[model samples]
Target: MKQFAMLIYPGFTALDLIGPQTVFSTFRDAKIHLVWKTLDPVTTDAGITLLPTASFDTCPEELEILFVPGGVEGTIAVMKDGEVLDFLAARAEQASYVTSVCTGSLVLGAAGLLRGYRATTHWAFREMLPLLGAEPVDARYVEDRNRITGGGVTSGIDFGLRIDAKLQGEEAAQLA
Candidate 1:
């Protein structure tokens, strides 16, 4: 199975997680892990709650992909979360791919993962990329080496499909 670790934190935007997850769900051989600091219920900025299926301590040692979803306040907080940022920096070294959607890029940047990489995020926050030493691009998603960052929430679907194509094949992505 292709293992995926998806970060879920308090106040994560629902669509940011769901959009990419929907695409990943199409693959029968995929293992999607909703990961958090602990296996607890995480509330979204939209007021909805999601139960985490795994914790950072329990997550696979290596992953096919490490994904982070985004929310404004949450992203801001995560940018300052030393623990989460440290975990991401460590895991990203072993994972095949490192990714984020919307302001999640800022968190990745905070983790020191985006330095000198070309990336993109929610349009409103695109200007912030340079602060992290990331080259801001205006595309819906930017792929630099193994790091990928998607635009706003709705763009996650496209990002997921693209990743599916990269890991599988065009035929698989088309089917998804």
Candidate 2:
């Protein structure tokens, strides 16, 4: 099975994670991991709570996708979190695709995974990409090699569909 690890943290935007997750769930041979520092319930900015299925320590060493979702205050805090960054950096080395939605690209940047890559994020955070060593792009989503990043919250659906097309073909993505 293809393993997908999606990072979750307090205050994440629900749509940023769920939209893509809904798309990924359509894959027949993929296993999704809602990962966090611990296997605790993480609440979203919209007050939705999600339980993580894996902790940083328990996430698979090799993965088909390593994903991060965006937030407001929570994102800013995660960007400076050494443990989270370390986990992302380590897992990214072995992941087939490293991805994010909305401001989640900032978290990838914090992990030093976006340096020298073209990426996009929520419009408000686009300028901040340069500070993190990435070339900012204005688009619904930008894919640079193995890194795929989406714009604001709603753009996650488009991002997920695009990734689904890449992995499972256009017909599969269209059906989704």
- TM values, all candidates: 0.98, 0.99
How well is each residue in 132-153 modelled by candidate 2, as lDDT tens digits?
9999999999999999999999
Whose lDDT is greatest here? 2
What ranges in model 1 sit over 4 Å off? none
Off by over 4 Å in 2: none
Q: How close is candidate 2 to the true structure, as a TM-score?
A: 0.99
Residue 4 in model 2: shift from native, Å?
A: 0.3
| Maximum-TM-score candidate | 2
